[model samples]
Structure formats: structure tokens, C-alpha cells
Target: DTAVSQTPKYLVTQMGNDKSIKCEQNLGHDTMYWYKQDSKKFLKIMFSYNNKELIINETVPNRFSPKSPDKAHLNLHINSLELGDSAVYFCASSQDGKDYNIQYFGAGTRLSVL
Candidate 1:
């Protein structure tokens, strides 16, 4: 079983289009998060949910939305995609630092705007 998984490892699409990335974790953690990594490899948290409730919403654009159907799954949807939005999106989960935990990351979804 995978600790965290994301589909469509690479995606190439035209600008102004919409796309979605799916993620799931099996670590039985209550907190899940989404992060964006730019070409510079700077990882920043976008959104975080704990126990199905949103606990953190970073300065992410409105076009980017995160949905968690359950504590084990968090999906990201981006509308009107722009070239600037093309980056590697990662899904992560942690134990909320309760046990000095570190965030576990997925393989990441690479979105490329054409």
C-alpha cells in the first residue's frame, strides 16, 4: 500500500484550461495538505485540512481549490490555468506534529501549461 499517491505524474495542457489532481494517503493521519513547488524547488503549503475541516488556507489564488471528500483523500482543482500555474503540485500528510512527525509527500503531479 502506498503512503501517499497522485495520478497523472505529468500533464501538459493549454493555458486557460482546467484540470484536477487526485491524492490519497493511507497513513491514518488526520491532517492532509497540498503544496506547490516552483522551478526553484521552493515548497510552500497551499491548503491543509484536519479531520475534514480546513485548518489552513495559504495565499493561494481563488482559481486553485482543494477538496477533501474524507480524511484520506484530498484533491486539487485548478481553473483557468495559466503558465504561471505550471509547477509540481505535491500532496502531503502529517500527524499534526503531535509526535514530532514529518510531512510525507507524494510523487507529485507536474502540470505544464502550453
Candidate 2:
């Protein structure tokens, strides 16, 4: 089984709409993160969670939020989505929220806002 999995592998929507991407990890990891990959393929960290506590929240718009109800799950919610929000969102997790720790990533959710 995949260590990390994200639902709605492909999402195509219009602007000004709200949407969410669900993510889950089965690796029993204590740290989870949300990342966004733009058209140029640069991955940026959006949010990070360790043992259900928010940490390392990057400079993202208020429209974006990471909801972590538990240690194994961290979902991303985007409100009033804009055209610029179109990109691939990835969910990742590691054994701990420590530097140099190897993180396992999901296939990614491709979001297209037309």
C-alpha cells in the first residue's frame, strides 16, 4: 500500500470556487506536510504538522488552510480559488518533524482553475 494517498487525483474547476483535497498517511508518521508544485515544478511547503500540532506554516494566502484532525491526516482547503491556484498539490509525511528526515509523498492532486 502507498504510504501516502490523496483523493481526487485530478481536479478541474472554475475560479471563485472553494475546494478541498483530502490526504492520509499509513506510515504511522508523526509529521505531515502540504506542498504545492507550480507550473515550473518548484515545490513549496504550505503547511506542516507534527503530532496534530501546527508548525512551520509557510507564507501562504489566508485562502489556503491545512486542517489536521489527527497525526496521520492533513487535508488542504482552498477558498475562493483563483486561476493562479492551478497546480499540483502534494501530501507528504515523515517519521518526525525533524530536518534531514526523509518524507514520503503521495502521487499528487492536479488542480486546474479555469
Candidate 3:
């Protein structure tokens, strides 16, 4: 079974349109996170939730939102998508408050805005 899976491994669309990416983990972890990796391969944390409660909301734009229905699922919704929003979105997870641990990542959903 897949540990983590995200829909539309690749997404292509135009600017100002709205889109969403869904993520799920089967590892039964208590925490999940969304991260964006730019073309330069720099990763930045966007949002994180532990046990369905929001714990971290980074400097991401208002156009982007994250929803966690449960401890195992976290979805990202983007509105008025912009060219800058075109990047690799990765869903990751780790044991809550366990720093020094590696976060399991999905293959990634690449969003391309034209």
C-alpha cells in the first residue's frame, strides 16, 4: 500500500484559475505538512497540522489554503493561481514534535501555470 499519495502528479493550467491538490498518508502519523519546493530546489514549509489541528502556517499567500480533514489527510487548495505558484508541492509527515526525524514525502505534485 502507498504510504503517501497525491493526486494529479502533474497539473497544468492558466493563471487566475483555481486548483487543488489532495494528500493522504497511511502511516497513522499524528502530524502532516505541506511544503513547496521552488525550481531552485529550495524547500519551504507552507503549513502543518497535528491531529487535525493547525500548528504551523508559514508565510504562504492567502490564495493558498490547506485543509486537514483528519490526522491522515491534508489537502491544499489554491485560488487565483499565479505563475509563481507553479512549483512542486510535497506532502510530508513525521511524528509530532520529533525534530531530528525525517519527514516522509510523496512523489510530489507539480503545478504549472501558463
Candidate 4:
């Protein structure tokens, strides 16, 4: 079984559309995160959830929202998607409040906006 999984491994949409990606993990982790990898291959954290409580990165725009229905799931929603939103999104899970915990990443969802 996959430790982390993301649905709709590919997403193609026009600007101003709304899209969502779902993720789930079975590793019994308490924290889950959403990361965006730009074309330049820079990966940055968009949002994080610990036990269903949200902790968003300040640099992330409000257009991105992360919802964690439970400790093992984290979903990302993008409203009014822009061309700049076209990137690979990754879902990850790790133990909560651990500085050295290793995060397991799911296969990324590639989003293309035109």
C-alpha cells in the first residue's frame, strides 16, 4: 500500500477556474502538508495541518486553501486559479512537532493552466 497518495495526478484547466486535489496517508502521522514545486523546481510549503488544525505559510496567497478532514488526509483547493498556479503539488506527512521527522511525499499532481 502507498504511504501517501494524491488523486488526479494531472490537472489541466484554464485561468479563473477552480480546482481541488485530494491526498491521503496511512502512515499514522499527525501532520500533513501541501507543497508547490514551480517550474524552476523550487519546492515551498503552502499549508500544513497538525491534528486537523491549520497552519499556513505567510507567503502563500489566500487563493490556496488546505483542508484536513483527519490526521491522515489533507486536501488542497485553489480558487480563481492563475497561470502562475501551474505547478506540481505534493502532499506530505510527518510526525507532529518533531524537528527531525522525515516527511513522506506523495506522487505530485501536475497542474497546467492556460
Candidate 5:
């Protein structure tokens, strides 16, 4: 079975709408991350959480937030969506919040703003 999974593989919403992408991991990892891939294919880390505690928040816009209600789940919530926010969002997990650890990635959620 896949270790990481994301719901709503494809999301289409208006510019002012709010939406969320849900992610869950069954690998028993303590750390989870949210990453955004822009149109240019540049990937940036948005947020990181360990054991449901947020540990890293990168330079993402305030409209974008990561919420982890438990160690097994981490979700991304976007407020007042915009065209510039359209991109591929990925959910990843690792044993711990370390770069050296093997990270498992979800199939990714593609968001489109129209």
C-alpha cells in the first residue's frame, strides 16, 4: 500500500474561493511536509510538521496554511485562492524532520484557479 496519499487529485476553483488538500500517511512517520511546485516546475517547501507540531514554515504566502490535527495527517488550507496559487501541491513524510531521511511522496494534488 502507498505510504502517503492525497485527496482530490485535481482541484478547480475560482480566484476567491477557499479549498483544502488532505493528506495522510500510514508509514508511521513523525514528520510531514507540504510543498508547492510552480508553473516553472520549481519546488519550494511550504510547511513542515513533526508529531503534529509545526516545526518549519517557509516563505509561503499567509493565505496558505498547513494544519496537522494528528501525527498521521497533515492538510493544506488555502484562503482566497488566486491564479498565481495554481500549481501542484505535494504531501511528503519522513521518519523525522531530517533531509537525509527517506521521504515518501504522494501522487500530488493539482490545483487550478479559473
Candidate 6:
């Protein structure tokens, strides 16, 4: 079984549309995160959720939201998506209170906005 899984592996949409990506992890981790990879392949964290609490990254725009319905799931929602929002979104999970710094990542959802 996949440790982390994301739905809609590929998404192509026009500008000004709204979309959501769902994520789930079976690792029983306490910490979950959402990451975005730009066209240049620069990956950056957009949000982190620990035990169902939200922790947004300062640089992430308000349009981008992370929602955790439970410890095993984290979802990403984007409103009025723009061209710049086109990127690969990754969901990750790790054990909380650990110094291991290791996170398991999902296959990623590639969103393309035209």
C-alpha cells in the first residue's frame, strides 16, 4: 500500500477556476504538509498540519488553503487559480516531535492553469 497518496494526479484548467487536491497517508504520522513545485522545479512548503491544526507558511498566499479533516488526511484548495498556481503539489507526512527531519511524500498532483 502507498504510504501517501494524492488524488487527481494531473489537473489542467483555465485561469480563474477553483480546484482542490486531496491527500491521505497510511503511515499514522502526526505531522502533514503541503508543498508546491514551480515550473523551475523549486519546491517550497505551503502549509503544515500537526494533529489536525493548521500552520500556514508566511509566504503562501491566502488563496491557497490547507485543510486537515483528520490526522491521516490533508487537502489543498486553491481559489481563483492563476497561471502562477500551475505546479506540482506534494503531500507529505512525518512523525511529530522527532528530529529525524524525514518526510514521506506523495506522487504529487500536477496542476496546469492556462
For residue 32, model 4's alpha carbon misses the true position, in angstroms, by 0.3
Clashes per candidate, residues 3 or more apart or on different chains? 0, 0, 0, 0, 0, 0
Query: What lDDT, from 0 to 1, does candidate 6 have?
Result: 0.92
| Model 2: per-residue Cα lDDT over 42-107, one tens digit each | 999999999989988899999998999999899999999999999999999998646577989999
lDDT, candidate 3, residue 106?
93
Model 5 ranges with Cα > 4 A deviation: 97-99
The lowest-lDDT stretch of 10 consecutive residues in candidate 3 is 93-102
State the lDDT of candidate 3 residue by residue for 8-112, as single tens digits: 799999999999999999988898999999999999999999999999999889999899989999999999999999899999988865665579999999999
lDDT for model 2 comes to 0.94
Which digits, one per residue and each the tens of the lDDT, describe model 1 over residues 14-110?
A: 9999999999999999999999999999999999999889999999899998999999999999999999998999999998758775899999999
Local error of candidate 5 at residue 34 (angstroms):
0.2
Q: Each candidate: RMSD to true structure? A: 1.0, 1.4, 1.2, 1.3, 1.5, 1.1
Least accurate stretch of 10 residues (summed lDDT) in model 2? Answer: 95-104
User: What local lDDT score does residue 83 receive in model 6, on the 0 to 100 scale?
Assistant: 90
Residues 30-61, model 4: lDDT tens digits = 88889889999999988889899986564888
Model 6's TM-score against the true structure:
0.95
* List of clashing residue pairs for candidate 2: none
Cα displacement (Å) at residue 58, model 2: 0.7
Which tens-of-lDDT digit does each residue in 1-114 have in candidate 5?
988999989999999999999999999999999999998999888999999999999988899988999999999999999999999999999996465878899999999999
